[model samples]
Target: MQKLPLTLLLATVATTSAQAEGWYGSAKLNSARQNLSSALLTSPRVNERVDAPDNTKTFTPAFAVGYAFMEGWRLEGEYTMPSSSTFKSYWAPFNANVNSLDTHSQRLMLNGYKDIPLNDWLSFYGMAGVGLARIDSDGYQTNETRRFAGNRRHNFAYSVGLGLDAKVSEKVTLGVGYRYVSMGDVETGYNTFANRITARDEQLKGKLKEQNLFLEARVAF
Candidate 1:
């Protein structure tokens, strides 16, 4: 099982500071929650859509690097390395299925927002960004009824985010945001020899919405 490299993860955060121009940077430690829609991925044979536990929590730590083009108007590149969780799916006899694939992701975002000062210590702003999520799935699938199931591969997904930002300090901000992400449809085997097919239709796929509660720290030159 290959995990995220420690050096790469640290470098991602280190870039938040030491930027130039309208160049600004931020770092946030947050709680990331996903709303997985279980109905859309159900098998046609399994008439009853069996419900599964939907809470996969992660210690989401991310960073953003943006530049103010003109006063309040800003544009930047954002990155978040959210740890991978067990991509679990359900089928008849094999209800609890997790093929060891270390499904992890990192997102790059493009943002736009306005910062309005409410008081000397309290400032607020609203922002929106498009997220490009990259995922790597390398797991083991043991199914007696499936053929050629589970492989090591990478998938790219995306999400749209809208949020509010609060300037808590001259160098810090509080953020609350919602992201509607395309989780895509996950396919599982019906039998040990039922040629396994797992495809994520970019268009018309299952959706997973994520809500993030975060705190950001910035350093202004």
Candidate 2:
């Protein structure tokens, strides 16, 4: 009976070693940065263009699932809904209360990863992917808040990431990574003055670039 148990244990270990392919699920806690482009506006007194300060950094979370199809390659799909960030224009000539926005985004991506093994328990990986993103915003002007009727746009986005992973158990790994993402320009049209003033009624434009530093936990089966 003792010999039989030892034989089974060795056989199980051999099987696990031979089969390095499995399904994995992961969750990440992300620290994100937001960037915006310059804006140009015209007021009754003058016309001015200004680059506003970057939005506040926010903490967001993301989730993904993947399968290792070969020894060093995996494919994954992920979803993230980042928290809202605010932007306010700071051009001196115009009215101070006329141009503020609240912005947020949701994204879905299909990514491919290549892993390089440093040792039995450590690896480094790089990944690239394409995705769809929707950017939404609300505009606030002088005395009223306006919802831009056609403000939301769906963009084709891309991302790249590099990371280090360490195996902590038979079925678990821990990861730390940095990722960069670019979502194209978003435009919005507004009528906050309710037709009383049509001269300054125009569209708002901005481009988005983001970076994320994250810690992830992944489980494989």
Candidate 3:
């Protein structure tokens, strides 16, 4: 279409071509509690009597940095600090009680985004990126007397997200977003501790995943 360039340019009226090329920082409070599927509670091998479902909720903080180039493309890197969550599971005297675990991750993303004009004061955009995350995790059995596996493992990660913007001025854009993320299999070794008397690492949690909500602000150059 002859008007394609104009159409694209017009869509950014609320944003300004004067946007600069530099590093922008963002901090966000997640909207949803991430789902950490429990391993001990759900593993069928832990004896059917001990077999339940493992589900815990977590809220984590998110941060990111981006470099804008040619007023369009961006190279981004984001990180989510791990959160600790505790829950109880019942099976028997030997393997019944609470379990505590901490999870953390870092992501390197190559992203593509388009800015659209919603009005004189509003703009909308969507971003899609492919990235990998390094996930570190650890878990412990609730019993104070007996020690279960309290080991750590690392994994790969990936994500996708979308957002909308409210232009406060020619240089500032307020935005909100939602994202879906996944972490690859987090492995805890069978017997790699000083004392191999732990009972929590009887099985693996496998691939871990999560969903996050983000609120952001952008200062366009």
Candidate 4:
């Protein structure tokens, strides 16, 4: 019957409107690995390019405030705290390895998520975000000699992830997820050796990427 179809449609709309709808805040801890593309180090004296190694893993923290506007959609703004990792690079020209070199990053993002209910207390979700990141380095050193000054740069960043969320209470949810993020590029300052300036103090440049596994908790209002 035509009237029966209309009644079912109205019921469906009502059901959707009654689903999760409110503002929420979340906190997350991420086990992150920083992957640096092979960097090129340039200098006038060297007369050739040199390559550097990538970075290691570290833990970082992130926080977000979001609004669940519809049954399965939400938007949030997230901020990731700065985390650092140490790496060593061998400079053939100097004939030594740079020690205690550290790099770190901080990010701010606007993210959107879509969720699908799997059961009464569980849901699966996917998310994507676009943002800005600031990457910094503490320069390079070999033994007691400083070869370059540190530098910082701001770049465009983006991420994508998937996860499962469990509702423990009407107001609390917990989740675990994995995401891949691109933090853009970074560069080091001009070269300096033994407290003296070089004739052509070229810089080192590289691209930065990250893979993160995160655990999070959210509370709705």
Name the 10 consecutive residues with the lowest summed lDDT in model 2: 37-46
Candidate 2 per-residue lDDT over residues 147-185, each given as its tens digit? 343478789999999999888888988999999988777
The C-alpha TM-scores of every prediction are 0.61, 0.81, 0.68, 0.83
lDDT of 4 by residue, 1-221 (tens): 79999887876654454357999999999999987775656555453334466568988999999999777899999999998866555556664545344678899999999988766677889999999999887566565366566889899999999999988888999999999999997777765664335353566667788999999999998
Q: In model 4, which regions exceed 4 Å deviation?
A: 1-19, 44-52, 91-95, 99-101, 194-197
For each of the candidates, the C-alpha root-mean-square deviation to the true structure, in angstroms, is 13.5, 6.0, 5.4, 4.4
Candidate 2 residue pairs in clash (backbone atoms < 3 Å): none
In what order do the candidates fall by TM-score, top score first? 4, 2, 3, 1
Compared with the true structure, the alpha-carbon lDDT of candidate 2 equals 0.74
Please write out the lDDT profile of model 1 over residues 1-221, one tens digit for every residue.
23568666554433332112356677777677755455233334333323443556777888878776544456767788766655344445445542222345566777676555443334455666765666543334344232223322233454555556555544565666555555443333222333234433111013344566666675443
Q: Which is the leading candidate under lDDT?
A: 4
- The global C-alpha lDDT for each of the candidates, from Candidate 1 onward, is 0.50, 0.74, 0.56, 0.79
Residue 44 miss distance in model 3 (angstroms): 9.4
